[model samples]
Target chain A: MIAAMTNANPNIRLDKRDLILTKGSEVMLRRGYHGTGVQEIVQAAGIPKGSFYHYFASKEDFAVHALEFLYAPRLQRYAQALGDRSLSPCQRILTFYGELLNHFRRQERPQYHCFIGSLSFEMAEPSQPIGLQVESILQRSVDILAQCLTEAREAGELNAATDCVELAEFIANAWEGTLMRMKAGANAAPLSVFLHQLERLLTPSP
Target chain B: MIAAMTNANPNIRLDKRDLILTKGSEVMLRRGYHGTGVQEIVQAAGIPKGSFYHYFASKEDFAVHALEFLYAPRLQRYAQALGDRSLSPCQRILTFYGELLNHFRRQERPQYHCFIGSLSFEMAEPSQPIGLQVESILQRSVDILAQCLTEAREAGELNAATDCVELAEFIANAWEGTLMRMKAGANAAPLSVFLHQLERLLTPSP
Candidate 1:
């Protein structure tokens, strides 16, 4: 995504902005907002402190843009995963979460839960605008799933009475919680349970 | 609980430690671990800076104890709620979550999701001991729910095929995720969806 963005926009200014956001997101996600400092972000980005100020007025402002930068690709992925036509809509939704759980299992150390979920948890400092942006990203994710669920029901894969929108919201929220547990490290594999329960949820009982 | 603790312990030293934890947990939950400072916690607890150090070796140590203080009451409440015989085992499990959702709805602002969930998300700093402690607390919570689920299945409330342990884990993870969404503020009420889905999962469809 970064390469494509720079290729599409030859502007040095936009390229530098993207560089800072990409590097800034990495640092922020690892260290969290307060744990990170302005100097740390600039150092990580290899940008001058002046350049950082030029792009973002404040750390909070940087976070908003960084979140926007982080979410764009993630939301795109969610749409891609759920909207994949090769799999039936039910499989697409189920497989999407299943694959994510696999990715979590492969991690060497406990990685952060979904960055956006962590950010929302850490965002107790009360930035209204940032809160609004996070809310929008969360909705977009749920909507992407909702679309696939709508397809599943239309295809007779799901029961006719299922509320696609509500199911989408529940799945999205549950998936976030699953990610939360993935980091906390439970005695039993939450994803296996999540996938098992999800299969039960999507498939009718005999 | 605090009242009971104080009544049981007449030691002045223990009383001071309890006061610090009570006040410290309140601040930590509201402001978060990194957001809060030792001095601020001292002020909140009305103890001297020297006294704060007397109780805890470091901020991280303070957080661990605070988490313990925080979880004790919460786990107690969970055990009490799930063990209440006035409700059937199925209703005990389902209604515990439903009531929690209603409580979330009553919140004036986006209160933090369960503190443990938030800390696990925020705990990206690689505190192995803290991580293990959180994991154990999570398991204890799951076990409490699992015991209730086992009873439900034994009482013929849930399907015979139900895996109570797995279901308990999934519900705990999903509920944590549901709380994550609760703070994010989605278009739909997650708790209602969570409750709706929980009902379906617990009660077999004819």
Candidate 2:
């Protein structure tokens, strides 16, 4: 059936897949993993219901791919910012978070949240496959941030005595917490405060 | 029908209600709002499907009450801790979080998360009644924390220049984020780090 459908719309197969993934990411981000249905995703993507099954095997399968779709570009951007040698390692970290806060600010919704943080809370159960996927993605992000912090410590841009790994974990966790609160409070004030405090906390005093 | 069902088990009315709410809170915390079914909640509670409907009108109604059921006692406990005059205001703040961290440490499941945080992420849409309930409960907690910070500031335990409201918001958000990370990482390290960092962040310079 999938082959038949793909054959019928060969030119649009790739585009349709992208469309589904993009729409899935948006709906899942807003409604959460359990709240969104495949039908809703198809409707939002403006594709036939049969097209959904053609592209993805199951909702869980779709969710895993949707998460990948959502995070891939963001991860690339994160790497670009963190790996920018033109900026000091510490400045790279700060600039990365600053850009994130700006992105959150530009969102039209009063309640802004992180897709990974939200999904992690909603689906990070031992019994759930998506939970494990979320855990891996989160760990990967923390690892990247830890690398940046280690570089900062080596460059004397951060406190030499600080545990960069632990600090990185704290930063990642704190920022995720800040996003959760931002959504709860229905404002960006928490994001702003987190950014300001994070910069101060990471900066060593003279 | 609900009234008849309640009258049928008049003496156990309150007990059964508590049972359902407790089980509902647990399932909702683990599975999320839309992810959990009414049947699952009833099964977990060992109550009949009829009993669930007898106690609550609908899933959203049940959720609102379940949130109240979960937060009310915690709020009282929080007040008791924060209002402990024997402890310095700063000590009270630290003690509350310390106990919370210990509680998180005691959970058997690696993916244990906050009920309020999970619900807020899953159901905190402006259009949803449950969202409003969650927002109100969260705001109340922040208000309580803010009050504690206010006391600390007045006692010179915290910096006078710090905005207690904003700091309280940050603390709440950061802690929520930390819980999300803790679940994702399957450990209590984030909770410990959050506590340590929060204390340091809030403490006035010598």
Candidate 3:
């Protein structure tokens, strides 16, 4: 949707829009939504303040787009992992989380599952629009995982009695909680706990 | 420590300090840390800006005290629940969460598990002092639960093979994740799943 808008305005350079969003999200991720300012983000991106307004209607609008901007490729990767045929359904889920853990482990500090977790936490109350966007994004992720879990159950890898959507919601919520802890402690031990428990959580029922 | 300071300085009124913290935390919870200002907090507190400074050295300092202030009574209640003699150890753990869920359910809004959860989400990266305080609070909670699980094991209610501390951390992290979801969706369904999964997660291993 935003891409259409960018293309419609021939004056708006894709690179510049991307630059503002990239820098804006980085600052927002580091300092949080309320912690960041439009001028600061424009400065970080080496763009004029006017250019930010040219591309975005308001700080809130920028955030809504920033969220979609940050999520697009990552969601693609997530969707791909969920549907990967090379691995069994259960294997796909575990391996996906394992790779994510390794990514966070390399940082040696709390990462926000790429900042969406924090934005959602920060936005949910203050800005209804962004909160709605964040919730929708979360639901998208949950839907992806639920689809994978559904396959797992059908393939006899998950418990036949399992409700895939509910389980997916639990795993996603649990992972979000683990990220909150990781941020507070600046440690990844909770990530380890998340992964360990993820295995137990996915085991088939008797 | 703060109580001692209050007693030593007859100039400072306990009720005034409490007012600032109570109002400050409420604003901070509704607005992200960076979203709020000392002026706004003081105005809401119905106190002079000087009063806020007298009790708290800085915004960071105020947040640290606020974190401590918000946590004190809740921690006391948590310790009580963990050590509650009427219920079995596992029952104590589950009942504690059940009661908390009911509290959030009554509000019809996503709550912070009493604001500490959101503060931890917001404070960790931007402010070191507050982050450390939040981590310590989380550690305290995890410790209480771990102690309860230890008793549960001793009473033969838990799987003997269970690593009580690790499991406690997982449960704590998972509950935090659950709360994050609750805040995002403004729904209590996640809480039900947390309770359901808590039972399964706590079940003795084969």
Top of the candidates by TM-score: 3
Candidate 3 chain A: 10-residue stretch with minimal lDDT:
A108-117
Error of 2 at A43 (Å): 5.9
True contacts kept of 3: 0.62
* lDDT over C-alpha atoms for residue B24 of model 1: 82
C-alpha lDDT of candidate 3 relative to the true structure: 0.84
Candidate 2 chain B: 10-residue stretch with minimal lDDT: B1-10
Q: Candidate 2 docking: what grade?
A: medium
Model 3: how large is the Cα RMSD against the reference? 2.7
TM-score for chain A in each prediction: 0.87, 0.84, 0.90
The DockQ score of candidate 2 comes to 0.49
Candidate 1 residue spans exceeding 4 A from truth = A1-10, A108-110, A186-188, B1-10, B186-188
**How do the predictions measure up, each by TM-score?**
0.90, 0.81, 0.91
Query: Compared with the true structure, what per-residue lDDT tens digits does model 3 show for residues B1-206?
Result: 55756586644577788889988888887777877899989999988888888888998899999988988888899999899999999999999999988887888675553466666766687778988999999999999999999999998889788889988998888888787777777888889989988887767766
Residue pairs clashing in model 1 are A177-B177
lDDT of 1 by residue, B1-206 (tens): 45546665547777798899888877766665666789889999998899999879988888788788779888999999999999999898878887777776776664653568657777734676566778888889999999999999898998788888998988888888777777766322778889998888888666
* Docking quality (DockQ) for each candidate: 0.56, 0.49, 0.60
On lDDT, the leading prediction is 3
Pairs of residues at least 3 apart in sequence or in different chains that clash in candidate 3:
A177-B177
Query: Between 1 and 2, whose DockQ is larger?
Result: 1
TM-score of 3: 0.91
How much is the lDDT of residue A147 in candidate 2?
92
* lDDT tens readout by residue for model 2, A57-137: 988889878778788787788888899999998899888888878887887766564677677777766436777777777
